[model samples]
Target: MATYAIGDLQGCYAELQSLLERICFDPTQDKLWLVGDLVNRGPGSLEVLRFVRSLGDSAITVLGNHDLHLLAVAAGLAKLHRGDTLDQLLNAPDCDELLHWLRQQRLLHAEENYVLVHAGLLPSWTVEQARGLAHEVESALRSDDYAEFFAQMYGNAPIAWSSELSGYQRLRVITNACTRMRICTPQGEMEFKFKGEVSKIPAGYLPWFEVPDRASRDATIVVGHWSALGLKVTPNLIALDTGCLWGGPMTAIRLDDRRLFQVGCNTPVAKDW
Candidate 1:
């Protein structure tokens, strides 16, 4: 059986279908690894959610920032933002079930020598440490106090990590690092504002994948949060966000051979937003 790691779907249902067809994906024998952000900002969030949900155990999806935002909005802890493309999902009768499934998904998933996360991991964490930290957020999201957790989720507090951190501060840091991080200063300071190409990182900041002497460098990391980075495949890192929701192609990579399958977008993204 083969495993395929796909970039952010971002509600691009037709592109996802076409990519699957191009790869001849076999749900019966092959597994699909999604880097999450399964919905939002594209034309078919509902369809994407429904089809992936129908896949059941055949697909392993981790949580992306957009996915968490959906959960928060559904929980009445947040509001639909200007560019959010989740109205159908917000009004769906099965919204609760969908949100539950989304919350139950882990922030990081690793098997054999491959690791899948919606975004990057801090340089400080080994794969095991990242997984453990991910579980902390997953537990809070799945707990009945999830709404309470949402209430405390908006900050960048406890901005640095240490072994001694505990409670919401710890969980928020972990969540931000996994779901929203792109660049950080060597001192582990997050630079959330920069969204340019690799060459554009500020003097003191480094891409998480480029962090010197990263503990998890031995493991292949497949992630999909930075559309600005596009579809990049290096020896140990695979970036799958190809700006699918921004008039670019939706991307997918075959795990066994690293072959790429992509579909172009017809309409431009709602760029004005």
Candidate 2:
């Protein structure tokens, strides 16, 4: 059974289907590792969510920022952003079921020597510690007061990790780092505003994976979120948001042998956001 780790889908259902065809994915024999953003932006948010949820145990998807935003909007804690294409999804009959499943999805997934997170882990967090921290946020997401968590989920403050952080502050930092982060200081202070190429990653910060002696550096990390960073593959890092929504190819990598399969985007959404 092969495992294929795919880039962000952001509601690109046609492209996802094409990429799956290219890989000849079989739900019974092959497992999928999806780097979230399963819904939003493109035209088929509802279709994407429904298809992924249908995969059940054959797929493991870590929550991306867009996925979280969908939940937040569903709960009335957030508004639909300008480029959001979630109306069809929110109006669907199984909206509640799909949102519930999406909410219950992990913020980080770890197995063997591979750690799958939607974005990056802080430099100070060991794989074990990161898993524990992820559980904290996951618990809130699954709890009765999850809407409250989403209400406080949006922010750029605290900017760094601390063992002393508590409440939503703690959860927010963990969520941001794992879902939205691209560049951060060596000290793990994140910068959320810069979403450009590595050459223009501001003055003091570097890509989170480039941090020296990162505690979770021992394991291979599969992440998306930073489409500008493109499909980066190294010994311990696999960054796979190939900007499919922006007309780039939807990419998938077979984890066992690092073989890649891609399909060109069929519908390119305007880069308005």
Q: Against the true structure, what is each candidate's TM-score? A: 0.97, 0.99
Model 2: residue 238 alpha-carbon error in angstroms: 0.4
Q: What would the per-residue lDDT of candidate 2 be over residues 140-212, giving only the tens digit for each residue?
A: 9999999999999999988999999999999999999999999999999999999999999899999999999
In model 2, the clashing pairs are: none
Best by lDDT: 2
Q: Counting only residues 3 or more apart in sequence or on different chains, how many pairs clash (N, Cα, C under 3 Å) in candidate 2?
A: 0
Instruction: Candidate 1: list runs displaced more than 4 Å.
Output: none
Q: Which residue pairs clash in candidate 1? A: none
Candidate 2 C-alpha error for residue 121, in Å: 0.4
Task: For model 2, give the RMSD to the true fold.
Answer: 0.6
Per-prediction backbone clash count: 0, 0
Candidate 1 accuracy as lDDT: 0.88
Off by over 4 Å in 2: none
